[model samples]
Target: MIMYLLMGLTAAVVSYGATWGARVVGNRLELHMPIRSRDMHSTPVSRLGGVAIFLGVLVALIVASQSFFVKDIYRHNFSPWGVLAGATLIVLVGVADDLLDIRWWVKLIGQSAAALVVAIWGVRMTIVPWVPEPIFLENEMIRIVLTAGLIVTTMNAFNFIDGLDGLAAGVAIIGGTAFFFTAYWVHRNAVLLDYSDLATLLMAVVVGSCIGFLPHNWFPSKIFMGDSGAMLIGLLFAAAGIVSTGQITSGLYDRANGISTVIPILLPFAVLFLPLLDLGLAVVRRTARGRSPWSADRGHLHHKLLDIGYSHRTAVILMYLWTAVLSFGGLAFAVFPWQPVLAADIFATLLMGLVTAWPYLRRGSDEPVA
Candidate 1:
């Protein structure tokens, strides 16, 4: 407990300091991405805020790894070096995009290459409990591909949802905190004990990064995360999920009769359902309209919220609320058994769904913004 708290504080301080430094350097360097055609911000903001977050997280990891109190936390089969290399690749690519307006294809290629590196380092998903393992490919290959795909998808999903001030950072913080508890519980349960410590450390890094950046990023934002911060956060989330699922005890598949192995894997997804769903919806909407999926537009759910009379602060808060609801709700279900927790989740989700859709449903009427 002490180790985790200390690590979290270190990460938060470093991330916050990095953001301040980035803002100064970014202004001097004029590092900014051009306003997308559909952008809602009236003025340009520095896009290099992600540099700070990346650095902060990197520093936090270094500190945690070296600390006596936490050395054992990540000394097992997990490879922090691989995670760092992957994060560096994404950060470099994102920074290039923010500064030079790199084409979408270029960014995609970079992300794929980075993901492949992580996959090759053996950080991929290979099992889906209850389902027969793929016959054609070896377990190693399956792990690499699945892990790489998750890394790429998560990186992009996070970038896609960075539409509103504080939205991405807030959600990242909430999701990270939820993962921390889940991993801690798994540790206590003695299931995947080898990886539990590392998982907790990773969660601390994420939480620190988000909390440190929130002050400057909240509504009436001074700076944006740009590709750098958003992509890094996504990668961290993906890595955490991989770590959690990878820690499952082998042969437990045969022991658990009714539930699927996907139960643990789905936890991260449930925590981040909103952003991933937004990404999926964006892809489908763009394809349906015969537009490039990468094309920027005001059709995002956040934009829709704004269009439907939500103040900027209200929209951001609403996003935060939903993120917490889903993330914590998922954690609750995971900590408890299916029957009781699932019932609670169902009731909570239904209430949230109604509230979330309320804005859209009342669009035609003269309803006041509640």
Candidate 2:
């Protein structure tokens, strides 16, 4: 526990410090993101903030590995290094997109290449998360393809939700925190599981990075995470999921700890529901209109909320509320027979719905949202 805390602190401090320096470097390099019709920010912001986030996580890993206590957490595996490799690849593409406006096809190629690296690094699905029983796969090719697909899809899901200021980072913080605690709990309780400690460390590093970067990305932001930061965090989240779900070899995983043996697998999707929905809808909508699936538009959920007259901050907060309710609620239901908690989530959803629709429900007032 002490080791985890110390390592997380190290990641946070390094991330925070790097973010401050990234701003100056970005400015000097003229890595500024100009205003676009699809964007809300009026002024250009630095796009290399992701460099700081990556540095922070890397430095923390290096520093933590130097400690004997931290070494023991990962003594059995080298999966974390694989995660770093894939994430580095994505960051390279993202930085290129941020600075040079790389084509979407080019970015897709880069993302797929990164996913392949992750798959080769052994962070892949060996067992299918199916009903009745989990079937273990012996075919390495299938596992590699499936693992790479999952990683790429998750990376895009998170990038889609990076529409509002602080949205991606804040939502990630909530999701990562939930997974981190669950990993920690499993480590303390699932005594037969050798990889629980490793899972916990991966999640801790992810959560700590978000915490360290949030201050620079909050509402009315100073520095934008841009594509570089967005895709990097997304890859981190995806890699953590891959490692936790696939790297564990314990027999106990077949047995349900609370509600299901697949909670870890389902939790990532639950927390990421909004983004996935938005991405899917965008794909369908664009295809129906004879546009490329990757075409940029203002039809995301955030865009709708803005169209309905919510201020940028209000829309972001409402999205945050929705994300928290679903994410935390799903985790609670998975881990406990908490009936009241479900009811509370439902009630909160209703309250938030009423607030979101109040302007429309009023049936008058031509004035726009102030």
Candidate 3:
């Protein structure tokens, strides 16, 4: 536990330094994300923030590979390298899109290619969820295809919500923190010693990167993460989920009842509930209006909050609150009695709901009872 925390701190420090370097390079190269119709920022900002985040994760992983406690993970398998390669591939694709505004199909192809790289290197999804029997995707081909599809989908889902300063990075921090704890528990409890806490290690790096990046990305930002940063975050999350939940054994599932069985299946989604929900809504809303799902618009939840009179910082913070509540709730379920966790989650959700609606309701009351 202490080792992972130290690794995360290492990642954060490296990422912070790398972000400053990236900003300077971006300015020199004149690479900026121009203010678009759907964007919130008024001025053009450097979009090379992803490069810094990637560097931070890279340096931390390299250090981990040399560490006495974690070096065994490298010898165990090549899956960790696969995540690095995939992250590198996705960041390149994102950088191109950020600079050139590449065609949607081209970006999709790039995402698929990156996903395939991770899948082929033995991080394929091996287990199926929500079934009576512990059904594992034993066929190597099926596992690869499922894993790639999931990675691609998750990348896009996160990309869709990178609309506000610090939103994507902050959410990644929340999700990665949740992932680390759950993965750590599974590693200690389960019989899958071969995985060697790979998911936890990956998330430690991810959360650290986001922590390092958030200051530069906060409201009235100096730099936007652009497609590269958001997609990299999503890919890392998916890869960690694959290694964590996708490796659960039937023995663990069968032996434990109550929350344990469900948590392994639900933990990934619980952490990413908001982004995935926004993604689902965007696809449906666009397709219904005969627009391409990839097309940008101001109908996102964050935009809605803005339209309803929330300040930029407040809207982002509220979203963070919701993400934290859902994420930590799931983490609690895994460790404690489900009944209390569920009750607390419900109370927290109601409080958030009231907080969200209070402004509008107060405005209505101020209006002359017409």
Which candidate leads in TM-score?
Answer: 3
lDDT of 2 by residue, 1-370 (tens): 7777777778788888888898888877777867889988888888777787788788777776677666765566767778778888888998999888888999999999998888888478787665555578899999999889988888888888898888888888787777776666555555553433655676677667778888988878877777777888777777777666663456434333443556666677777788889889999999999999888888998888888788888888888888887787666654566576668778977987898787667645656767
Query: In candidate 2, which residue pairs get closer than 3 Å at backbone N, Cα or C atoms, i.e. clash?
Result: none
Off by over 4 Å in 1: 73-78, 129-137, 191-196, 250-262, 363-370
Q: List, residue by residue over 1-370, the lDDT tens digit for candidate 3.
A: 8888888999999999899988888888989867788988787789999999999899999999998677788886888898899999999999999999999999999999999999998488987765554476779999999999999889998998899899999989987898788777756666665545778898999999889989988988888888999999999999988876665564443323364457776778988888999999999999999999988898998998898899999999999998898888888877777788889999999999999998898998899965
**Ten contiguous residues minimizing lDDT sum, candidate 3:** 250-259
Task: Itemize residue pairs with steric clashes in candidate 1.
Answer: 50-229
List TM-scores for all candidates, in order: 0.91, 0.91, 0.95
Each prediction's whole-model lDDT (CA): 0.78, 0.77, 0.86
Better of 2 and 3 by TM-score: 3
**Candidate 2 weakest lDDT stretch, 10 residues:** 251-260
- Say which prediction, candidate 1 or candidate 2, comes out ahead on lDDT: 1
Backbone clashes under 3 angstroms, per model: 1, 0, 0
lDDT by residue for model 1 over 1-370, one digit each (tens)?
6778788888889889989988888878877777777776887788878888888788988887788757775566556667778888989999998899788899999998888877776366654433334122357767787788888999988988999999999999988898888777656655444433666777888888889998988877888888888988888788878766765544322222234354565578887798898899999999999998877778887888888778888888888888887888777765566687778888888887878778777774666757
Name the candidate that leads on lDDT: 3
Model 2 misplacement above 4 A = 193-196, 247-258, 338-347, 363-370
